[model samples]
Target: MNLKLIKGMRIVAATHNPGKVPEIAALLGEDYEILTAGQLNLPEPDETETTFTGNAMLKARHAAEQSGEVALADDSGMSVAVLDGAPGIFSARWAGPGKDFAVAMKKVEDRLEEIGATDRAAWFTSALAVAWPGGPCVVVEGVVHGRLTFPPRGDRGFGYDPIFIPEGGALTFGEMEPAAKEAISHRTRAFAKLRAALID
Candidate 1:
């Protein structure tokens, strides 16, 4: 479907994440005004969809309808090949209600150890959806193959960043600078498709 051209450059982001706002702003360019769902006090919609694309579209449509504005949504997670993608969609939930990645990271490491898994293959997937108040929407998905690192690394980025090392890269996502991470990020890749289809 075609993405409705956003007017007034105002979009309600269907997310409670403050980190995501600036990342999206950078990807979409400075001209667009990105407003977080938290800032707008919009209710965070439940992600009932089985796939990332489904969830992204659900959130985007919910936000667009609730705020009467264009809405953008991202649903992303890390999948471990050895674990059979145990945490694929439950990435955030793995962190528990406290949103503690340290605990989550430990859990991942522990799970790996429990299975005696030597394979470190993993990938991050990001699905993006943009919805207009009128009900039109555009969706895209991106993936970056990588491997998992033990004990996690660095102190930057968020979520499972510390344990993920992109292909041909030595540093984990947490260790890379924002610019470095953004350059090859799953979100950036998804936005690339969105830009080609809508913005470009």
Candidate 2:
């Protein structure tokens, strides 16, 4: 996205998720000042788009327009191979209005049982977008393949972390230390792509 070309030191993180800000900041490092939509009380725009890249771009564009600065946004979710990505974009909605991830996790388990599906293959996908006020935008996507675990596990991460076991890893994301998970996270991979674009 040629972040260096952007004429500013401050950029808005176009998200309200409490868990996402710190992770994104850590990934972006200290080169730019990071501010969030919540900090500025920016109203969240409706995520009417259907794809990760579409949603991420929607949020980034909204934030940049509102804040008059560059903005970054991400849309991420878990896609089950058997479910044919049932909750791909609906991952958040699966948590229902209360946003109770516990309930959502159970729903996934129940569905698997109902279908008698034994293949637990799944993947976490993240699409990141950066946009400037009334100008250019760039989007990138990254994924981490994994399998689902029933009854969930651990208590370290938010969302579906407790149920996902990364490829070649014995521990679920919720079971890993924050730094450990960050090292191979889907978000981390996506951020690497974004960072490369900026630095290149």
Q: Which regions of candidate 2 deviate over 4 angstroms?
A: 1-8
Count of clashes in candidate 1: 0
Which residue pairs in model 2 clash with each other? none
Candidate 1 lDDT over 8-69, as tens digits, reads 57988898889888778878888788899989899988889988899999999999999998
Per-candidate Cα RMSD to the true structure, in Å, reads 1.6, 1.8
Clashes of each: 0, 0
Q: In model 2, where is the ten-residue run with the lowest total lDDT? A: 1-10
Error of 2 at 37 (Å): 1.3
What is each predicted model's overall lDDT from 0 to 1? 0.90, 0.90
